[model samples]
Target chain A: MPQIFRRGRFWIQLGVVVALMAFGGLLINNITVNLIRTGLGLDFGWLWRPAGFALAETALPYAPTDSYAWALVIGWMNSLKVILVGLLLATMLGVAAGAARSSRNRLLRSLSGGYVALIRQVPLLLQLLFWYFVAFLGLPDTPVGGLIHFSNQGIRLLGLNLSVEFCSVLTGLVVFTGASIAEIVRGGINAVSLGQWEAFRSLGLLEGVGLRRIVLPQALPAILPALTSQFLNLAKNSTLAIAVGYADLYAVSDTTITQTGRAIEGFLLLLLSFLLLNLLISGGMALMNGAVLGRLQRSR
Target chain B: MNRWLDRWLTLMLLALLGWAGWSCLHWLWRGADWTVVVTNLPLYAVGSYPEAERWRPLLCIVAVVVLIVITLLGTRHGEWRRSLPLLWSAMAPLGIWLLAGGLGLSPVGTQSWGGFSLTLLLTAGSGLLALPLGIVLALGRRSDLPVLRGGSTAYIELMRAIPLIAVLFFGQLLIPLFLPPGVEINRVLRAVVAFALFAAAYIAEDVRGGLQAIPPTQREAAAVLGLSPRQSLQLVVLPQALRVALPSLTNQAVGLLQNTSLMAILGLVELLGISRSLLANPAFIGRYLEVYIWLAAVYWLACTAMALLARHLEIQLDPVRSAR
Candidate 1:
């Protein structure tokens, strides 16, 4: 009976593998036939072609005459720039708002609660449009002390100039993702014991110091895992920069594919780039998590 | 000093709130024109579905609203409560039939399907398809067979790693290439397939989380009861696991609805897509604020309604609560 059961399992596994291969083969055969019919067989020589479309913003020097590969690299850098800055700003906003939710002040708690409720309910794309068309574009052209400038065209703070598209995408991503991260932070903090809060109070620790030194440290293990996922989500959501014409990685890829009509090759490149991005993010978080756990263990 | 600090913070917050409220009120009264939303109500709801046939999508929306009200209000009644799941399951088919319209009414081409109806169809259609596919993937990942486990894990991780717009874009561009030369799918169907494929990966993770929460003894107990493994899964394990997954699944459903707006970029005239074209028209050219605010409110309400319905289902499915 045991031998028969083992044989049945082996056969089932074999069947599944064979079926998958057959389905895959059929799809590939069709793709080859379609490619031949359309005369667009897969090729990467287009990457060397000049990309004629102008980018609204670039972190590195770029022009319409640049190679498609160069344009894509610039776009990837732009994505990385926004994502890193957005992650930092969002974490600050999220932690502040999340801590506010647990603050002793009733108004502060309700305000943060309201923020999360309002932000989470609306679609991020709509908010991005709002920030672009209504908020940033509606700004009056005003120069402040030769140090800062705000206008319908763009914004300048200190020595840095920012386009309306980039500003809107950043603001939208920060606000939308901040709301989710706030929820995660709040949940993580809540997991810390009521006793911990009381213990800190009894010791007469200042609210900021207690939260920073005591409560938050204990909450890190729980918060870090959820926070990692939220960070991944923010990275993914940054692609919506396309809707606002921010020239992020996906937007550039979209334009490239449209111009060259190389959908499969473009998609493959996009996929590989994203997989690398995801690995970089999750790997960084894993390191932080290990450090946090190590420190916590050492202290104990 | 601490008391003074608290009072100062309160005053500052209050002042900021007051200014924001005043500005919002001023915008509503004088700075905003809502005629953009008011004038295009039909277009927003049915998206230029033939003027004569607007009633089909309207009826479908009305049916859904009525069903929601009935389920919320009538779930206490025994027979009505028992039939609620059936009615909910029937909605997607009913919606498709009403909008597609071949049985007794004129059949409308998908090109004419747009607005809120298309949005609802995309969400419901993809969701209905994704749920079962997700369950199978989750089971496969948890399967003892090495090939099944590795394949399912690879698919889920790969799908999750890519951004959704990329998936939808390729779905529009490349779905044709994968099919036999003569066989083709419409844009709406392609979008649905892509959405389902993308969403199933996320849903499988949620279901896996729920599956892991179930105690091992439940399966052992089922075995002791002489139940086959299939029967044990179908009867004992899956029901409990799904119930445990209900809240997270609700989040996915809401996320799916919001993500449907991504379809607008691919040129399907769902709610946001219809609005995008309307905004492009010379007349409504600069009325982005009014249109966007209206869209935001519509999405918020729809998402809230979904959340409430899911909460109701969660309560209904609770063994302790239902026992009462």
Candidate 2:
């Protein structure tokens, strides 16, 4: 009987299950009592009420009279806007810097290396504040009569009309994410064996052609997983928009909670939306990975 | 053909660099305000904490640095290695006691803590707390027990899906609400809890990667030697797994350190928070640029130091690299 008790799966399972249940029960009991004492119950009815605040930036139409739910949607839209634009810019910057690091020109290599080292070493929050509060805001405001414009033409230069908050958040995300992506890109390039380059040289191909035709194809498979993580990171980092007074989902949620005292509902929307967004990104990337790998295999 | 293309690219890049240099020079000459940063240097360093209590944070820093040095020395000698965990664990409470101050020492409230020291404290505190919890979660995820496995997996996935900012918000807003009435957890403690819990998820995933890398034979060998599963895990499994996980672990530490800056939003006057406070000061109204530059430089220096230490550790840990 003792041996059976020691070795049996039944007892272990029962013990684990019971312990889990008891923990859950204790948590629920605490929350219930706490909620009762606060003169409030756990309900999301506050979300249906007016938000009564305007978003600083929104891709979708938003007004002060919108429901808190609509406010969250607008916040979500703004978050998505930053993520999409930031991802594009970060990828471009990453590729350029990553490629430049391996350039024949000593100046290009050192410049890119310095950028990666400096940018990656600082916290993203500080960089965001710098870009927004200092870099953008400190710019002498569009000199009364428009900074620069061609006569009767639509062209303009250094007008600086974009919101400082938005510019800061976007620049911060790009600079930070781009540094990481550059490292991944550099690693991916290095992982492509030197033999490929030699093969291109034997075929009398130019350096640019060799890199584009021979190196990048091989590097893509290696780069994709890391690149996907960076994309996810940028998406999440967009939440830093709150710090700069940008009305991203997190910022809006903070306002909602402050206004309505429904922390649970406010955070639940944030958690669910982010989870869905990440699932979509990962799922899309997985499909792309499969397609790329399948093509590589067929070519082989 | 290649030369022509290279020449055109280089020329364009040079022109771009020149324009950037000119703009920077112009800004430095006309825009920057130096006096604001100079006058508020003390405020940036320690917020508005009492001048008499200044030695507390300094003591915390000295104790932590000494503990780290001793730990490093112990590991290098391999003689005091077994006691290292005990010593390391003690350092956290010790550091806290020194900073928070209770017996004979003047008590400095959590609200009083701010600036670079607070940032470092949060990073170190959360990191130390999270490592062991992360290892357990990683093990639980890999365990045969369905409940433990399911629970850990759920936790890690849920945490990974959300941003750190949201988790912190919940820490500030929800955690207090869930606690029993009349029980007060200070804001700094709440932020620390949030950071540890948040970091545990990522650390678990990183550790899980290490655990997965271990071959079945090592565990089987431990079993054949009459070792219990717990013994096998504590002795044979964890050492090898952690060795493999060290680089990723260091990366997570650096990331967590950086994430501690988010504490500013929770109203902790850490590095970024202190900077914001400086910017908001009426006297320093337009000196945001100069202050931010200083803040970024400090972070850059600290982060670079940590990154370099990580590189050194990576080299030391790798048998092939260390031999050279």
Candidate 3:
């Protein structure tokens, strides 16, 4: 009976393998036929072709004469620029709001709670549009303290000319992601024992100092994992920059695909780029995790 | 010192809130023109469906609303609670049948499907498809077969690595190419497929977490009770795992509903899409603040409702509470 059961399992596994292979083959065959019919075979030769479309925002100097590959690289830099900055600002806002959730002050706790509840409910795209059309674009042409210039056209802060599109995308991402991060941070802080907070207070440490030194360090391990995923989410959400006409990687790929009519190639390149981006984020987080864990262990 | 600081912070917050509330009230009274939302109410609800046939989508939406209310209210009634899942599961097919039409009614093209109805359709359709696919992938990842495990892991990881918009974009572009020359799928179908594919990866991970939480004793007990492995899995394991996973799955469902708005960018007239078109109208131009505020309220209410429904189910499924 046992032998029969083993044979049955093997047969079932074999059947699954066969079925999957056959399905895969049929799809591949259809793709090949469709490609041939359309005269669009998969190839990467378009990478060297000059992308004639102009970008609204480029981190590195770029022109319409640049190769598609070069255009993509510039868009990537633009993506990196917004993502890194958004991550930093979001973390600051999130940590502040998250810590405030547990504050003794009723106003502070409810304010942060309201922020998280309200922001998390709305879609990010709507918020991005709100920021772009209603908030940033509605700004009057006035300079604040003669250092920051605000107008419907664009913002100029400390001699940095920021496009309305970039500002809106960055603001939307930070605000939206900050709410999520705040939740994670609150959960992390909550996971720490009441005894720890009491112990620190008994030691006569100040509330702020005790939180920074005693409570936060302990919450770091729990917070870091969720924080990494949120950072990755922000990276992924950065692709929504396209909605506001920001010349991010996905937007550039979209234009390249439309102009060159190389949907397959463009898609493959996008998948590869995003995979690389995800790896970079997770890899960096892993390193941080290691360093923090090491320090925590040694201190123990 | 702490008392002073707390008092200062409270005063500052109160002043800011008061000013903001006053400004909002002023704008609401004077500056805002809500005719954009008021006049386009039908368009926002059903989106360009033939005026006579608009009732189909409307009825579907009303049915869903009613069902949600009923489920929320009837959770404590044991017999009625058992049928709620069946009714909920029936919604997607019922929606498709009502909206797509065929046997007894005029078939509406997917192009005509838009507005909040379309958003609901997309969420329900993708969610219905993803749940089973995700469950299978989760089980496969933990299976004894090496080939199955590796394949499932690879697919889930690869899918999760990419952003959702790329998947949806390519689904619109590549799905047709992958199909036979004469075969075709509508854009709505394509979007649903893409969403399901993307969501399944995340769902699989959540389900896997739930599965890992189950103890080996349950399986051993099932076997001792003379149940076959398949029966044991279907009868004893999956239900408990899914119950454990209900909260995260609810989050995914809410996220899916919010994400259907991304279809607006791809040119489908879901909730946000309809608003975009409405805002672009010459008359409603520059009414972004009013339109966005309306959209935010709708989304917030919808999401809150979903969270509440899930909480109700969670309570219903709680073994300890049920035992009481």
Candidate 4:
């Protein structure tokens, strides 16, 4: 009888959970029905129309006359471009800043402290906007006009630089993402035990060698997870290019939604692009984490 | 050899700092015009805001400060030594002020505080709203009630799987449709709802981690105390569970602050939006480095303050549990 009561209670609890979930599903269903009624019933036909606008920066071959699908694909490429460039830039900046923060030199330590604090407190959007507006906008005109064009193609600065839009976007992404990376790097380095640092230093191993071998090896576990999220952050943040009118994936999708009034389709594409990119980021990072974990275990 | 290298590096860094400081001073002070930047930034902050509406933000700021003071009272120690939490609490507002118009002296309107400020508002609001929702969601997810668990699991996993911007875009599209026709919601509010829902899902995960951390012994002891399941969990389990999860929770809050900058895409006029607007000015061409430097300083300060405060709170809550 006691066994029966115990089994029955278990089933009863399970039943309640099932019922609640069903209610949640019902709510979602109602939301979907409401969406369909508002002239937004699902269809992919809008994607076939021409995008009529040209991107200032894209990695793929594209024209204003390209299909919305192709334009979106190009925009996705542009987002990837920023994410890739941003990742490299942030990683480099973070590593350097992290090392700088770890320095025994008090001046370098204070400088890094100020740098990290300044970057982390303000929003990245402000930083990007500031970069684009105040810094880019404040450029002095060279001789004849506003933008200097080079070799009959692409915007130039001081007649020497090429690809100003890409450069500007790249610069914004690097600095914005770099600040977070610096913190991550600092944390990872700090995670290395004090004993490990002393042991390495006592052996006449230089600061760089101690950091590279004894500290960083131990620090990787701490750093990897932070870096993973930062990578995810970098990917999501790429969408901010829309504000600067930089024509990244999200920006192009916004333009498409405005032009075609296909908000549903436009958003779907934007979502899927980000979803896939993030999957790649998360998946890659997880794999990297697994590798690191295996190595950590082996070392143990 | 090491000492020589150190000396050379110091001299090089000093030289770099000297050049940077000198050039920045020249540019702001003499090169083009400080008058233009000084005027433009203020115009964005307080320009279109009605004088009375101005009190709203000030009130909000006071409320935030009050909350911080109250939360600080919840702690038993100085916030500065706690590192991450202190970094976040102090710096987030300071950064916001710098981005939002520096204590309202150089006031920028809500419309002008684009980029980071917009992101911060949206993210901060969402995070606050999500906390309760996350508790409910987590309770549902772990409920003895089968349907509730299923619902929470579906909601959480789906949200976790979807990128946040998609959630933002969907909210943008669907919010107006749900509203009575001609009664429009602001873009920022819509963004907040999206962010809240997304944050709830993540918070659920965080809550779940806390939930799992509670030992079976604690629950058994609660039952021995003759408490109901809810009472037992709330009083005994949760305190310990949440204490364990404090660091991750603080980390999430920090990330949310940084992520709030994403609102620049929606044209919601936060800090980033202000910077971009200023950057596009015909007069301030090629000042990307200058704006970025200023804005970066503001962000770092805000993030640092928050991190420090949270770290302080975590320590106060449980000295034995300190991880850092």
List model 3 lDDT by residue over B1-324, tens digit each. 867888998999999999999999999999999999999999999999999999999999999999999987775677887788898888888999999999899999999999999999999999989999999999988887767889999999999888888999999999999999999999999999999999999999999989888898888888889988778888988899999999999989999999999999999999999999998899998999999999999999999999999998898789999899
Candidates by DockQ, descending order: 3, 1, 2, 4
Off by over 4 Å in 4: A1-40, A136-162, A293-300, B31-49, B52-125, B139-154, B157-165, B178-188, B254-265, B269-312, B315-324
- Tens digits of per-residue lDDT, candidate 1, A61-109, equal 9999999999999999999999999999999999999989999888889
> A121-168, model 4: which lDDT tens digit per residue?
666666666666555655554445745543323346565544545556
Q: What TM value does chain B of candidate 2 have?
A: 0.88
Q: lDDT by residue for model 2 over A258-300, one digit each (tens)?
A: 8888777677777889889999889988999999889888988
- TM-score for each candidate, following the candidate numbering: 0.98, 0.90, 0.98, 0.77
TM-score of 2: 0.90
lDDT of 2 by residue, B1-324 (tens): 777877887888899999999988998999776887788666666666689987767666666566556644535555676576677668667777877889988888888888766887799888988999999899878877677779899999999889998898899887877776778899988898999999999999999989889898888888889988777878888888988998889889888888888888777898888877777778877777677778778777667667666666566668687578
In angstroms, the error of model 4 at A79 is 1.5
Better of 3 and 4 by DockQ: 3
Off by over 4 Å in 2: A1-9, A140-162, B7-33, B62-90, B319-324
Clashes of each: 0, 0, 0, 95
lDDT, candidates in the order shown: 0.92, 0.81, 0.92, 0.70
- State in Å the error of residue B29, model 2: 6.7
**Which candidate model has the greater DockQ, 2 or 3?**
3
Docking class of 1: medium
TM-score of 4: 0.77
